[model samples]
Target: MLFEDPVFASRMLSLLTLSIHAIFATLGVGLPLMIIIAHWLGIKKNDEHYLLMARRWARGFVVLVAVGVVTGTAIALQLALLWPNFMEMAGHVIALPLFMEVFAFFFEAIFLGIYLYTWNRFDDQRKHLLLLIPVAIGATMSAFFITTVNGFMNAPTGFQIIGGQMTGVSPIEAMFNPATPTKAAHVISTAFMTSAFVLAALAAYRLLKGAQHVYYKKALHLMMVVGLIFAIATAVIGDFAGKYLAKHQPEKLAAAEWHFETMEGAPLVLFGILDDEQNVRFGLEIPYALSILAHNHPQAEVIGLNEFPQEWHPPLFIHYLFDLMVIIGVWLVLFSFVYWWGMRRKWTIVTSRWFRRLIVASGPLAMLAIQAGWWMTEFGRQPWILRGVMTVEEAATQSPYVGHLFFFFLALYLILVIGVVVVLRNINQRFPLEQDLAHEGGERPWIT
Candidate 1:
């Protein structure tokens, strides 16, 4: 068990790195894309307010992206140090995407810098707007490459073991591996979904406080539209992604569905306690829904956790994560509908005290959705390091010092969190958007 102790430590280290990485991932993908889209619209319509909004958001995004890059680099380095066997075996297959991710990072930084400093240096509006294309593309490509690597992990491909050694690794095959496409699409959509909800929540807060300036209203409307669009898209794609997982990773689907055995026309446990020893759900159930969802048949049989030995069972913690994600997603969809309907009738919901309460709650809900979504992805794989080839324990750092990495990252993230709060406070204090625009700069471009 002493040797196995390091395995747990290694997992905790990776989780720390992953959790930090998730923050960056959310900001890196979500903030930049939103700003870029806003910037594009700004340039197209000659709307100075839109451009100003874009610049402010981009400034915040730049600061966050800097931290994101630092945390991401740390994660990549730790991956090699902690999972040497996994790296040595699968690194070659993922080399191309990893290399592309680096390029994406550099390219995004380059354009972002130029755009930050080149407003006066470049007189042509069209040329200036062109700079954003690369910035947007680079940010998106960075996320896409990382998602591809993650996807490959879920459904590995592009290599073989010959005489106990992985050989003939193919990058192309790995990029198009079994789970890569669907997983990438799912993650990409979730990023947008979480971002929209977060932005909407912020805008809703402002709207509720009677900050009815033109700029704030515009921002709120934009956020609402974005939230509605991404919410609907996420629902459709999530369904597709779920069906894909059901076909390929049935055990994971079973765990998420909370099914305890092979059963006919399984009742879906919407909210329940899994009695693993007794192999039954001990709470609320929706009759025959699981069978219909998983197999499109009312009486279709679904396998469950009891079919696998206790040692091989996926962690119950992970099953809870899956449930949390699904529940939050459904909540988002419902809230989005309410918001959209209220907006059509002149934002009656935002002015109401009850809606303001809900708006405040949505901030944490959005964050929980992001964390839960990732938890499901990483934890649902369960024992697999490569989904059919290796176990999590087998792929972990064999070294005793792995726990140090976890503590190091915990301290680092605490510092980063403090820094983020300080920066946000300073921005709000110095340039309070709720106040009159004349007090700031008389509609001139002011970067926060």
Candidate 2:
């Protein structure tokens, strides 16, 4: 029945677009901070290497932001075209944050252009680097506003709905809903971690290829430190997020852990296959772990999906996705610690063949973890687009052509992906390496 539904087709299309957009969006959010920091370091050390790295990275950041904008615009259009009913009803309530995000986007774009264009124009390094402050803030604020809007969707507050109509709107309350803090922190932290790992991974790859230049090594070290900190922070913040879910959306918590029966001392299902008979097949669960994790006590009661109607239960497959995210997160933490330990001992961990392989793999693993985390959050909220307010079916457009549009968008996304990859590869090839520029006395040829 789901396969035959146009709503399902539209939902899938929208999810596809969002997932692809998320890659660029996370980079867009994270790269600015790194760029600004690199510029600061350059100014502090009076080292041309750091400045060159920052400028080179900024060019790539510009490309990512440009692509992000296009994909982001596509998502906005999809929301209206695919789920008009939901947008029409709640648009006003969510509009404030969305509008703020647009302003943030514009702000980021304006400064980014100026920062990129004026790389060598200002002789004062401090003055040149100052432009990146607003660029970083604007990029981060864009993520904050958009994430708050999503948080509102999960928690749904600041308004009264009667007979399918909203009234007594409080934009401030909606913007800073109960879920805002945890969700915003988690999202932003992951962005930083993702970007750091990605950059580190690329640099590590080059290192393994015999490009053992100081510039690459420095970049790798900087990104690794930042990535490790955020990776550890994400795990801790994730626990807080879990607790929030247990209190606010117990059914989602149940589904996430695959707890089918309501009882005390709920075991945490680590890996399981849920079946039609409400049993976990070939499952591995830790006794009382769910209770302790959710409420910090082994005896605490954890609600289960059976307590809610069949339609209210979230998809069970999200359990595996949640598990995958946790597993990868733990791996990142351990890997970071090992890398740090090696660094402390003055070991050439970055050049080690096996370690380099792991480092290169870290980027894709982090990306997967971020995607999985989102899958759990979005899919775990399933059947309802606005939590208790509206079912996805109620919000989805009633159009027979959605399936066709889905294919069209799929093709378009493929093209966008190819274009981005080619463009980024070209940029990397054209950009001068630190060794290449050292002979020129640290002068950048690209800067006019």
Best by the TM-score measure: 2
| Whole-model lDDT per candidate | 0.75, 0.88
lDDT per residue for candidate 1 within 284-326, as digits (tens), equals 6789877877777879888877787765566666667766777
Write down the lDDT that model 2 would get.
0.88
Off by over 4 Å in 1: 1-4, 43-46, 121-126, 207-212, 296-300, 309-311, 434-436, 439-448
lDDT of 2 by residue, 266-324 (tens): 88988867777878888887899899878989999998889999899899889989999
What range of 10 consecutive residues in model 1 has the weakest lDDT sum? 439-448
Quality of model 1 by C-alpha lDDT: 0.75
**Candidate 2: TM-score?**
0.96
The TM-scores of all predictions, comma-separated, are 0.91, 0.96
**After best superposition, candidate 2 residue 50: deviation in angstroms?**
1.9
